[model samples]
Target: MSDLRRRALAGGKTVSRKARSKPESGLSSGNHTPNGSPGNSRAGSRANSRPGSRYASEDEYASESENDDIMTISTNSVSGEDDPGNTWAERLQDRVAELQDRKRSSVQGREATLGAYNHLLKHHFAQRQLDKSVAELMPILLRGIRNGSSDEERLRTLQAFTLTVLTCSPETIFEQALPILKAACQDADAENVKVEAIYALCIAVSYGGGSSTAAEETLDFFLEIIESDGQSVGAPDSGAVVTAALQAWAFVASHMEDLTVQSEAAIEAFIEQLDSSDPDVQTSAGVNIALLFEAAREYEEETGESFDMQYNQHRIMTRMAEIVRDSSKSVSKKGRRHLRSNFSSIVTSLERGKGPGYSTAGRAGPNPHTGGPRTDEQGEFREFGYRERIRIYNQFLLINTWSLHSRAELLKTLLGGGFGIHYLENPIVKDILGSADVEYIPNAKSRK
Candidate 1:
């Protein structure tokens, strides 16, 4: 074993050599129950003492049928049938039973316990034990993750228990795990540790951290990690770390409610990424930027902040329009298609609610400093739905129309100059270059 440990270190893999004896109760192996009863484990005892732990003292539902929403989603389909007799809770108890059967806390023994806890959480999640009663299981899982002696064990335990954290209420889970995950994302830890922590934080916030403030806090850390490599460009570790940070950003965007300044900053950063020399960085940035657009919500900033309605909408639109024009001539068809599709969705939706300083063609709008939904006759916040929907449809037409005009402008340049003028009199060419109109670019034919 000592030789194996040395060999593992030579290979640069994380290793552990901690030795532990089996407990008198055989808790190391999952075969034996903690209190000689399936659900009556040590964690269960601890749970009974914690506040708001439904799993400890209450069987909230009269039966599985009463578990209505929680029991609706099942893993039975994925796992296949033959186990209609057993519930998810029963299967989790079985894994815990195996955990108790382990005789030692060696690397192998620790792995066995991790596997057991992972399966337990999997079943628990599929069951959607909606009581938010994590107390019955949280401590034991936390112990495994925290007590992990090797980097390898820590990573595995972190992933598993952080998953268990999802079964917790967002507020509770964020309070307990956010600080630890954030600390781990810092420079003091190994690269792998930081990456795993970011991964876990992604899942936690995406699933349970409803607090936009938490999302805001988490977003700041990741953006720093991503921007750190600005000087080196394509340096190795930087690329991987930046990709992970982008993933975290996308997850947070999916869960956040308001992202006025944050979203714009992210948009600009991703736009910068579009210019990266590295193809991988470009690809990641492109996809994530699109995903960000798809996930974007209305801008909500309570604090007095500057937001120019025209600048915000027009800047993004112009960039996207440029990308579209480039795509028409560029070899990379995929990048063009992706930008066009996501851009259409965003450009159309962004202008629906015109806050202050919006040039909506004499249309009435809310105060720009306090842009929000308009209230109805009864004095409740309600949208002018008909007007808004009409505006959205018009915005779509405006974007496409401008794109056509751009095409016309480019065509005029081609037809009016050089040897290209020889084909100008062709029938199809003449029809497209009609004597200029209110919508065509340049306002008049440049045949001269």
Candidate 2:
């Protein structure tokens, strides 16, 4: 609700949702379908036009008619003799003709993105007019990707350009697309645009280009976002944007190889999520912490030395325990207790000293440490496999296995949910639940 954050989301303008219709966002489901790529068609002719199509987020804004930001409407109601006129068709033709007539190198910014979209329209609506190649079209996109005035403009430009890049050679993308995406991720704009930028950055990684510096910068950027205690998370639309951010952070974390100081930073950020008022945020944070653990484990296995996740593991676990243990008006007992139970399950299933081979989704295989059925009837898409799963979980088999016993109070804190099995059939920590001496730590400080 802070003025600054509001302005960021609104692109410095204030408009009621019903009054102002946003344009379509550019997050593509697969490879983008810019004008010339395989299976490519004019984006204008296909996207969101179809019912039941997986459209962009509902917040998408832009249109030749409704979105003032994306479209430049003519002042005159009637079309002049020389001008194509005020009709949408004529406007579309005029824009495309203008782009084709203008020098490509000069195109930049929001205008440039509009031009690219117009180009998609030209190719899709009228192939006889089609003469541009993917190679020729890319520079305009790169320019637009770097040039948009608003977050919406940048995101749309990136979305329109996605299929083209996906279809092109990866090496070219490594050189051209990578920088554009990195800049977007680092740029100052709305949180939604930043979320898109992070997504584009992660998408760029799949292309196999960029320097180590770019990689480090991408990794560091998300970690910074993670550690940032931005007040924007409270906004209604903010969750959708933050969810994109968390997902992007997960993508970057899983792909990056080395374990650096930012790993600790990322872990700290996830730990902070434990205190979020939102249950979804809490759940995502809990899930992603497991990701960092697996990544750290991967780095150590690849190299002989320890990756030094040693910084906050104990303290973080202590906090998780405290959240679950504390029964106060301040904390959501159900959510916190459930999260703690999940953490304990992860601890129980993972080998004491091994790194996690599986991902958060358990794409590798069935988790060995957690021997019970990984399948859930409600988990419509959850798929657990074999050794790939086995190999993946190995890294986290022994995660946070340090002696909490030395701090008996912390051990007791973890026990608060020992028999709390809302998440699974097993006790949160079976071994601890069976112990004779452990008692719930009373009156732990409230999670901030």
Query: For residue 146, what is the lDDT in candidate 1?
Result: 53
CA displacement after TM-score superposition, residue 159 of candidate 2 (Å): 2.0
Cα-based lDDT at residue 432, candidate 1: 35
Q: On residues 77-152, what C-alpha lDDT tens digit does candidate 1 reach at each position?
A: 1121333343435444443443333343455445545533443443333224423234534444455545556665
TM-score of 1: 0.46
Lowest lDDT block of 10, candidate 2: 48-57
Clashes of each: 13, 34
Tens digits of lDDT, candidate 2, 1-448: 2321211011222323321211111112232211111111212211111011011111111122222222222211111223222233333333333333334322232334253343333122222222233444556566767876555556655654543333332445656677676666556355555555555665565443656666667666655555564333322334434444555566445445565756667777777777765544554565567666666666678787687775556666666566556534455665445455455533432433322222234433344557554455423444231111100111111122111111111111111111122111222222322322222324543222
Number of the top-ranking candidate, with TM-score as the measure: 1
What lDDT does candidate 2 reach at residue 203?
A: 51
Off by over 4 Å in 2: 1-132, 149-152, 174-189, 205-208, 230-245, 299-304, 311-318, 321-448
Top candidate when judged by lDDT against the true structure: 1
